[model samples]
Target chain A: MYVTLKDGIHDPQGKAVKDALSVLGFNGVEQVRVGKYFELDIAETSLETAGPLVNGMCDQLLANTVIEKYRYELIEK
Target chain B: MYVTLKDGIHDPQGKAVKDALSVLGFNGVEQVRVGKYFELDIAETSLETAGPLVNGMCDQLLANTVIEKYRYELIEK
Candidate 1:
């Protein structure tokens, strides 16, 4: 699951990123926001099965889905 | 970053796992704790450089480090 700040949201971490960029001498870096990327293991045979399982995981467990917006991609092991 | 509850810690999510298992008719499943696994894109030239950067990311932003323990692996793009 990749979790990020929705557009126009206030992000303290993103502000910190801007601060860091200035310190690092990277100019013209206007904005930055932090997000989370998650990889989960599912006992599914393929992406089709994994999709619903992962979505359930997100809806029921992984993400709040209300305050945060998340998207995920399944990778085979 | 992989974020998980410290050993012996109480996890509400894990309890949810237990509940789900029972609902799913899976017997003898005593415990389960969900964790966060994150894959990040780095601009580093090598793992050596990426390691410190990732650790910095964990410390500075990604994981709380104080409450949740986290570890990460970098995948080249």
Candidate 2:
């Protein structure tokens, strides 16, 4: 799962990181947007059941949909 | 760039998310590891130059090599 702040939203954390990089002498950096990524180990389930399940999980738990958005990809293990 | 906690590292934040998921009835999750993803818009440059540059940025500022490691993919735009 990846949860990123909506476009046009201020990302102070990313700004801080970019600033730090500039201070470290990396001048080519034009912009930086930071987001959260998650690796989830889940029990085996059908894709049909897993899609809504994970969507619910993201909307209800992992991300704040009002200010951020999330997308997930599932791989069977 | 993707920055993830090294294996065996304790992640209380990920643990809290897992616990919350369990309490919210999404119990199929066995593990949750959280990480950071960075989308960087950098000046157009040759891949050879970009590779070492981004690696240096990650090592020096984006990730703490002691506990976190980072990998990045470059795309021309």
Question: lDDT at B34 for candidate 1?
Answer: 60
**Model 2 over residues B1-77: C-alpha lDDT tens digits?**
88999999998888988999999999998899999999999995687789999989888888999999788998988
Q: Give the winner by lDDT.
A: 2
Once superposed on the true structure, which residue ranges of model 2 sit more than 4 Å away at CA? none
lDDT of 1 by residue, A2-77 (tens): 6666667677876766677557544444455566545344556687876776666556654666666778766776
lDDT of the structure predicted as candidate 2? 0.90
Look at candidate 2 and tell me the lDDT of residue A37: 92
lDDT of 2 at B60: 86
* Candidate 2 residue lDDT tens string, A1-77: 99999999999988988899899888888899999999888885787888898899999989999999888898886
Shift in Å, residue A73, candidate 1: 17
Please list all clashing residue pairs in model 2, or write none if there are none. Answer: none
